[model samples]
Target chain A: MSVNARTMSDDELFYGHKACPGCGGALVVRQALKVLGKDAVAALPAGCMSATGFNFPQLAFANNAMITPFAATASVLSGIEAGLRAQGIKPDGCTVVGFAGDGGTADIGLQALSGAIDRNDDVLYFCYDNEAYMNTGIQRSSETPFGASTTTTPAGPSHPGCVTGKKDLFAMVAAQGIPYAATASIGYPNDLLKKVEKARDIRGTRFIHVMAPCPVGWGFPSSDTIALGKGIVDCGLWYLAEYEDGRFTLNRDPGRFASVADHLRSQSRYRALTDADIVTIEAHRDQVWQRLRQRCSCESS
Target chain B: MLEVIWHARGGQGAFTAARVLGAAASADPDTFALAFPTFGPERRGAPMRAYTKIAARPIGDRSASRRAAIVVYLDDTLFADGWEDELAEGGVVLLNSKVAHPDARVVTVDGSGLAADILGRAIPNTVFLGAIAALCDAVTLENVEEGIRATMPAKLHERNIAVVRAAYDLVAGRARADALPCCSEAAPIEGASGEKEREASSVVSAEPPARIIPQLQELTVAPERFARSTCFQGGHLVSKNAGWRSLRPLVDQQACTGCFNCYLLCPDGTIYKQPGAGSSSTVAIDYDFCKGCGICAKACPAHCIAMVEEGGGRDEALHIRQ
Candidate 1:
C-alpha cells in the first residue's frame, strides 16, 4: 500500500519530547520514523530534534536512536551502519538513518555529509529545513532565504534581512550522483512519506530535504506552521522534486504560483522587506523556476 | 526582603514582568533586585518559572526561592498541586483567572479578559504587574509605571502602563494584602469599603468553590524510577505535557470523516487512530502529550475539529468516529 495519512502505521516512534508546539521538524521526524519503522537505527545531530528528543533519562524515539556531534551526523550514521554490519548483528529490515537540521546539514556538518555521500554509505539522511539555526535563537544559516530576518541577519531601515538566496541543497547532493535525492515539505505529508518510503527501499546513499517551518523563528502563530509550509511551495519560494538515474523530475509544477507577497507578509521575519525587496525575491524565484522547467522533467512523481 | 516566584508559560512574558518588577523595586533608594528564569528545552506554551528578589541589601543568594512572599501565576492553569506550600506567612497567590478562587490567600483576576480588552490579545503578564503594585507595599503604582517605561520600549510604555493601572485598581479596590475578601461571584459586594467591608462576608461564608481537578492523562513511568542516566524506554514520556496548552481541539463525531489528517499532522503525535465498530476508523487525542498546536483542527478537511479554551472542559471520552 502507498504511504499516506490513512495507511501509516499506528505505532508512534517519536513522541513526548520538548519540541515547540506546531513544530514542523518534529512532524518530519515522526512521519519519517513511521515509514522507517522499529528496526531503523536513527542518529540525530545537535539540532532541534536531538536537543528536544534526548533529554536525560527520557528518550523520545521508540526505536534505537543516538545523538552525534554537531558535525558528525553522516559520519556517525556511516560508523553505525559499518559497526552493525561488521558485528553481523544488523537487523533484516533495519535502515541506518540521520536527521539533521538546515545548519547541521548545509553549514557546520556539510563536509562530513559530503564525505558520507561520496563513499555511497548505505544510509538515508533527512534535512528538516526550517531555513535557519532555530534551536540556537534563530541565527542565519546558508539555507536561510533572502528577505527573512534572523538574529545575525537583522532587517533594518537601511537593509532587508538575509540578502543571500537559499542554498540549493538537493541539487548539491544530486550533483554527486547519489542513488536518490528528493525535496519535500511538511505541509504535504503524503509526498514526504512517499519520499521517505522510497529512500528506505533504496540501498545506496539517499537524501531528502524537507521544509519544516518554525513558528517562533518565522514569527507566525503556532497554528499556521502547516499552512505556511504549504504556502511556501504554492508561492514558488519552494518546489517539490526528486533526482534519480541522472534525471531530475519536478513532482509539482504549481503552474500558477500563489501570492508571493501574501506569503512573505504573513511571516514577521519578512515584515521589514519592502515591496522592492519582494519584487527582487519574486524575480529570482521566477528565474530559478524558468531554468528548472527548461532543464528538469515537469512531471508528477 | 520580598521575593516573588512567577508561574507562566515560555512565551507569556513572565521573565519580562519579573525584570520589570525588579527594576521597579530597585528604583527605590538603598534597594537591590535580581530576576531570572528557569527553563529547559521546552518551547512556547511549555510551563516554566521566573523569579524576582528585592532586598534592602545586595542580594547574595542567586538560587531559586524556596518560598515566596508573592507567587503570581500568569496562567491560572499552573495553579496546581502543593501551590500553598510555596507561600510565606503573609504570602498571597495572585492568579490570572476568570473564575474567583475561594481561598482568601488566592486573589484571582480576570487578567486575560482585561488584556484582551486592552491590547486586543490575552497577554496577562502586565496585569499581574499591576496587581503586584496594589498588593505589595514595597512597590507603588508610580514605581511600576516608571519601571515599565525603563524596561520596555517607548512604543509599549503607554499601553503597558495603562494595563498596570487598570490591574492595580481592580485588585486594590477589591482586596488588600492583609485583610483578604472573597471575590466569588456568588456574593455581590457593592462598595470597596464602608457597609460592604466586614471580617467574614456572605461570600466568604458560602461554600468554597471545588478545587479544579483537571482530568489529565495519567503517566505510567516516573522520572525517578528510571535509574539509568543513559536511556529509558523509547517513547516513554514520564510526565504529561497537558500543562503546555491554553486551548484544546475537540472533534465533532457526526461531522468527522476520519481521514486521519489530524492524526498525521499533529507535531507532537498526540492524535491517535483507533479502529471503530467495523471497517471505519475513528481518531482520539492523547491529551497528555498534546501541546495544542492546532494543526489538527486546521488540517481537518471536514472542518469538524473545534479548538476551544483549554479548561472549558476535558475532551469527551474516546474515539471521534466517522
Candidate 2:
C-alpha cells in the first residue's frame, strides 16, 4: 500500500517515551518505523531519540530495537543484519535500520557509515539531523549550518555562531555510488514517508538524511517544529533530493526561494546572524544549488 | 536541619530555585546548605524533583530527603493525594496554585500569576523562593536577594528579586491577616477520595504513589532476574503524560476532513484514526501519551482542532492569555 496521509497505518510503533513536546526527531523515527513495519530491527546511537526512547521499564519501541555505540550506528546495523541472516531468523520484509543524529552520522559515525556503504550492507540508515548535538545541549557538529548558534560556537558581538558551512552529507554519501539515498524533512511527511517506503524495498545499503528540528535547542515554540521543518526546506536552507544507481535527482526546486532572513530570524539559534552573514549564507546556497542544478536532474515546478 | 523538596516539570528551574534557596540559607557564616536535582534522562516537561537541605553545622549525609519540612509544588498539576506524607511533622505543602484547598497543611499561592505579571512569563520557581523567605525562619528576604545575586546572571537579578519580594509580601500579608492556615492546625485532606473524579478530566494521576512504587521496584531488580536487559513489552509506559501539557487540543469532529495531517505530524503519534460511519475516519488524541505540543492542532488543515488550556488550572490560563 502507498504510504500517504490517509492510507498510513494507525498502529503506532514508537510511543510512550518522554521525547520533548513537538520533537521532530521523534516524528522521523515514528513515521519511518511505520513504513518499515514491525519486522524492522532498529538500532539507534547516543542521541535524543535513544536517550528519550530507551528509558528502563518504559521502552518506547514496540518493534525490536537496541542502542548502538555513539559512533557505531551503521556498523551495528551491519552486525545485526549479518547476525540475523546467519541465524536464518531474519524475517521476510525485515529491514535492519539505524537512526543516528547529525553528530552521530556526519561527525562521529561517518566512518562506519562509509564502511557500510563500501561493503553494500543490506541496511537502512537514517540520520535525523536537528542541525547540532542537541541531545548534549546544542553543541557544534559538522552538520551544524553556518551562523547557527551552539554552545561551542556561541554568537557574540565579535564572534559569529558557527564559522563553517554545513557539510555536504548527501554529496559525500552519493559520491560512493550507494544503491539508494534520499534527503527528507519532518515538514513534508508525505515525501518523507514515500522515501522511507522506497528505501525499505531496496536490497543494498540505503540512507535517508531527515531534517528534524529541535524546538528547545532551536529556540522556537514546540508547536513550530513541523512549521520550522517545512520552513527550512521552503526557505531554501535545506533541499529535497535523492541519489539512486549513479543518478542524482532534485525532488524540489523552489525556483524562487523564500525570505532566508525571515526563516533565520524565526529561530533564535540564528539571532546573531548579521546581514553580511545572511548574504554569505545566500551566496553559499546559490553556489550549492548552482552545482546541484548542473549535475542533478532538476524537477520543474 | 531544614529539608525541602521541590516537585516540578523538567525545564521549570526547580533545581535552580533549590540551589538559590540553599545559597540564601548558606549566606549565614555558620550555616551550610546543599541543593541538587534527581531525575531520569527524560526531556523537558517530564516530572522531576529537586531537594534543598539547610543546617547549622556541616552536613554529612548527601542522600535525597525522604521527608521534608516543606514540600513545594512548582506546578499545581503535580499535586497528588498523600502529599502530606512527604512532609515532616508540622511541615506545610507550599503549592503554586490559585485554587484554595480546605486542608490547612496545603497552602496555595498564585506564584505563576505573580511571576507572569512581573516577568512577562509564568516562571513560578523563584516565586516559591519568596514564599519560603516569608514562611521559613531559615532564610529572610535579604538572604533571598543575596541568593538571587549569587545564582542568577546580573541582568536577571533585578527582575527576579522583584518577583521574590512580591511573593514574600503576598505570603507575609496573608500570614499577618491570620488568613493563612497554620500547618500546626493541619486538617485531613477533605476531598482526597472525591478529587479522584475531578482528576480524570486532567492528567494528574489519581493514584500516583501506587504506580510509582512498582516502577521504582522494577528499576532495582536483582541481577538474578534470569533474563537479559531487553524489555519484551513494546511501547511500555511508566506514566501518563497529561501533566506535561499546559494547553490541550480539542478537535471538532464535524469540521475535521480526515486529512491525517495532524495524525501524521504528531511527534508522539498520540493522534489515532477512529473509524467513523462507513469508510470515513476521524482523528482522536490519546491524551495518555500526548505531550501537548499543539502540533496536531496547528497541522489541522480544516482548523477544527483548537488549542485550549488543559482542563483545570483556570488561573494559569489567565496569566497565559495575558
Candidate 3:
C-alpha cells in the first residue's frame, strides 16, 4: 500500500464481498474503511453493501463486520458499543460505524437511529442514500425524490412518477442536535474522507449522509456512478451542508446553479419528463434552494 | 454481434439467461458482451425483462435495449402482450412454450416444466441458455455450460448442465435452417462488428416517436385500467379490467409454503399476509402495488414460485428455470 493507500488500509473489513461493477455503495464502504482504519467495526444492514461484504468465507473486510437487521443497525451498534464498554475495552482509537441505505435510515430504521442520536451515542451513523431501495429493486422509498420514476411509481399517461418529495432527512437528523451531521457524496471522495476523519474524533453521534448513485436503479451508465453524485449536488437537488450542535454551515458554495432539466435529462428515471414537468421541477428546486439559503444565512450570522 | 432481449417472469431465469449469454460471448476471444436487467420489484409470475449485447467491439449506449436481433420469450404468453414490438424485423424468437406460433420464426421448448421435473425445482434459465445458443448461434452450448458452472454452486452444476443440454437439443432440432446461416460454423471473433451491425439496424429502422406528447389531446387514452383500480374482486376481475394492460403472477397453493419472506422482501410492499387462524396460511400479493422485482422468488428457500403469463393466467406455472 502506498502512503495514501496505507492511510486508507486495504485490509478486508467486510471481507469476501460481491458487488456489481462500479457499485457506488461498495465505494462508499471502501472509502469509509480508509478513514476509520482497521479498528473500526461496521454494523451493516441487509442492503447491497451487506450482501457484498459478507460473501461466505470470502469476507471483504480486514476489520470487524457484523450484519444486523434492516431497521436495527443503530440499535445493534449501540449494543456493540455498550458491550465493549462493559468489557473495560475502551474504544480509544476504535470507531463504531452503523451503515445503512436511505430506506433503513429515513423510513424503517428512523426511530432507532433517532433514539441513538438523541442519546448522543458515541458512534458514526452513515446513511448511503442511493435515492430508492436499490437492493430490493428500484422502488420508491421515503428518500425518493419527486418526479423520479421507480418500479412502483412508474411515469405513464396518468401517473407522473413519484409525486411525493424526498423526506427532509438531514433536517430531521440535524434536529437531534448531534455533535456533527454533514452531507457527503461519493463524487467528492476527499471531502467525504475529511468528514469521516472528523467524525472519527467526535465523541457524540456523528451523522454523514452520502448521496450514492445507482446505475442499475437510476438508468444511467455504470461508468457515470461518480458523475451522478456530482450532478446531483451541481443541480442543487442535493445540497452539501453540515450542522454542529444546531449551527449550520454550507460546505459547497452555491455557484451558478444548473437547470434541473439538465440534471433530469441525464437520468433514465426522468426520461418521461415533459416541459410542464420540467417547469414544475424547476419551481420546486428554486423553493428548496431558497429555504437552504435562508438556513445557511441564518447560521452564518 | 447480436442484441438479445429476454422476456420472462420474475422467478424465471431471464437474468440468468442474459448473464450466461454474456459470459459465453466473453469466453470467445473475438467477442465482447454486456448483460443487465431492467430492475423491477416484480414477484414470481410477473413479466420482467433482461437484456444482453454481444459485439466484436466494446459496447456503447449501455441502457435498456430498445430493439433486439434475438428475442427470447421464456414464457410463450408474452407474445400476446406486444413482445413482437421489441423484436427487430426478421429477428429470431426463441420461446419456452410447447405450442408453436407462426408470427415469427419460433423455437419452442418446455424448459421450465422440464427443469422442475428433473431438478425438483423450477429454474429454466439454464435451459433457455441452451435454446438461445441453438437458435441465435451467438454463443455455443459449451460456452453456456462453462458460464453455468462458473455461476452456479458445485452441487447444482450437473443439474444446470443437463437442463442446458436438453434446451440446446430442443432448439437445435426446431431452429430454422436459414435463420442465421452465417453464424452456424463461425468461431466467435471478439470485435465491434456485432455492435456496428446493431447500430446500423437501429439507424435503418424508423426512430420511435418521442414519448412526450406536445398536445394533450394527441395523447391516446390507455385502454387498461388495472393500475387505477384500488382493489381486485376475484380471478375474473384480473381478466376483466387488468387483463389487457397488466401482467399478474398466479401462485399455485400446492407449491406455495405461505412463507412471509415474499411479504418482507417485496420493495413495493405488495405482498400481504392475511391474518390466519394458524401458521400454515396463504400469502397474498397485491397486484395493484406489486412492481414485480422477482426478488421474492430469488429469496424463496422452497423454490415454489413461477411467473404466470400476462393478461390470462391459463398457462400457469410455465417454469422458466430448471
TM match of model 1 to true structure: 0.63
Q: Rank the candidates by lDDT, best first.
A: 1, 2, 3
User: Could you give candidate 3's per-residue lDDT for residues B1-322 as a string of tens digits?
Assistant: 4788888888787987798789887887657678998856758889999999876555655778887877778777776666667777667777777676765556667777888987878667777787777766677788988887777678988988888888778778856766464344332443334445457647834663332101112222232322222221110111111222234555555566766544433332335455444666656665543434354554455666555556555345545423
Instruction: Evaluate candidate 3 and give its CAPRI docking class based on DockQ.
Output: incorrect
For model 1, report DockQ: 0.27
lDDT string, candidate 1, B1-322, tens digits: 6789999999899999999999998897656689999999989999999999876545657889989888999998889989999988767999989899889889999999999888778999999989988877668899999999889999888888889999988999988645322212111222222134233345543763232111222455443334212444455555667889988888776567778889889988888877765677778888888898888888989888888886564344123322
| Candidate 1 lDDT | 0.85
- lDDT values for all models: 0.85, 0.85, 0.70
Q: How much is the lDDT of residue B204 in candidate 3?
A: 36
Count clashing residue pairs in model 1: 0
The lowest-lDDT stretch of 10 consecutive residues in candidate 3 chain B is B232-241
lDDT of 3 at B126: 78
> Which of the CAPRI classes, incorrect, acceptable, medium or high, describes model 2?
acceptable
**Structural similarity to truth (TM-score) of each candidate:** 0.63, 0.63, 0.48
Candidate 2's error at B65, in angstroms?
A: 33
Candidate that beats the other on DockQ, 2 or 3, i.e. the better one: 2
User: When only chain A is evaluated, what TM-score does every model earn?
Assistant: 0.98, 0.98, 0.93
